[model samples]
Target: MGEGNWARVKIILRSPASRLKGVCADARFSGPVGRPAVAPVLCINGPEDKLFRSQSADITLSSEKERIKKMLSEGSICEMNLEVELFALQDSNAKLVAALHEANANVEQWKKQLSAYQEETDRLRDQVADLETHGGHGPSDLLKDELTQSLEELESLLKAKDEEIHILQSKKSEYHELERDRGEAIHRLQELEMRNMDLERRVQNAEQTLASSLEERDRAENEVHRVIDILDVKIFDLNDLRQSLAKLIDK
Candidate 1:
């Protein structure tokens, strides 16, 4: 049987055996329970040299008149204070033992809770890493929209450049036919030079457009890095919280 239940039995059954039954020592129940159980401690007033000849721990207070106390002469109701003191010691011991058992159980429960918290924290960290990988270093909606806008702009510029390249090739073909009509004339030579100048200008514009597109790509990369840093900090916070809770549980 549980020690708590055993203690309760002793308290309930002690009434028929002694002047007063043993009391429950539960501090939590003390408001409803008035007194601690009174018990007898055998202090042999005999010679110390013979102390170990016999050691008796059990005592039974049979009735108001014929009760037995270990340390007291059998029929002597010597001191009220001594009787009260003995009972208090027994009650204190019972209460303390019960408290220790409760504390041990509580510690085990705390350990389980701490373990669960650590597992959850680890899972959240893994999720954060996955998000950083797929979310382009940033998981926020604003960053996502910015990246999308940049991609659209780059695609538009690329399509426009493709059309310009096509137009340039057609112009070059037309210029080649014009060259065929030339007859060692200065007008034809000047026209050819103007066509060459147009081609060079197109090349320069294409380079400038490519440079702007590269800048957009770099900005997008920076935003992604910034978001990754944010996730790292949040992960650290989660770990710290888990540790703190674990420490509390240990205590």
Candidate 2:
């Protein structure tokens, strides 16, 4: 038996033994109601009464023992199951945390790429303005080609950003599922709930920052397109001027 069980059994045994001793003491102290008692001596009940009471106490004690054993067994099983579940939850939480970290890292990397793209777009815009002020001379075609390439690259980056957003959305869904599973054990594990809430808050913050970054990228892409359109118009006008000059020289 376990220490706890042994302690309980000792209490059970003590109760009956103490009660029996008390009965003997009471019988010895009080004889017939008015008669004076002699020296304190052992008080004995009838053999049949003693036997019957002993048998009854034994039966009660045996039943209690069995009940306690059964409860202990059931409790052990429950504890084992809870341990298994706790292990599983810990493993899953670790994986989720690792994935969340990876996602955050990816977002940070994309943010850096977007910043670089924004800088490139600003430089291209300055180049286009310079070309316009100079009447679109000197390697106009090469600059136009470069601008087209940058535009394509920006569009591809935008597509990649959209894909990253989709991935984040999926991760969010997984988090929701994890939250629901954790909810089942929430009452039993307040500490896990607190940690989960903190993780959720972090994910929300990441999502907001990613959203803002996406907006900025969109604005930069629009500005680039506008600059490209202006360059195209300027190039067409320069082309017409070249054709008109060539016709005058031929005449």
Query: Which number leads on lDDT?
Result: 2
lDDT of 1 by residue, 119-237 (tens): 65556556556779987774567545655565565566557656755765665565454444332333444554555565455555555554554555455545555655554454444
Model 2 lDDT tens row, 164-215: 8898889878877876776666545554445445555555555555455455
- For each candidate in turn, the TM-score is 0.26, 0.49
List per-prediction Cα lDDT, in the order shown.
0.46, 0.62
On TM-score, the leading prediction is 2
**For model 2, what is the error of residue 91's alpha carbon versus the real structure, in angstroms, after optimal superposition?**
2.0
Candidate 1: deviation at residue 180, Å? 12
Off by over 4 Å in 2: 1-45, 137-139, 176-180, 183-186, 189-251
Give the Å error, residue 17, model 1: 60
Candidate 1, residue 237: Cα displacement in angstroms equals 0.7
Cand. 2 Cα-lDDT:
0.62
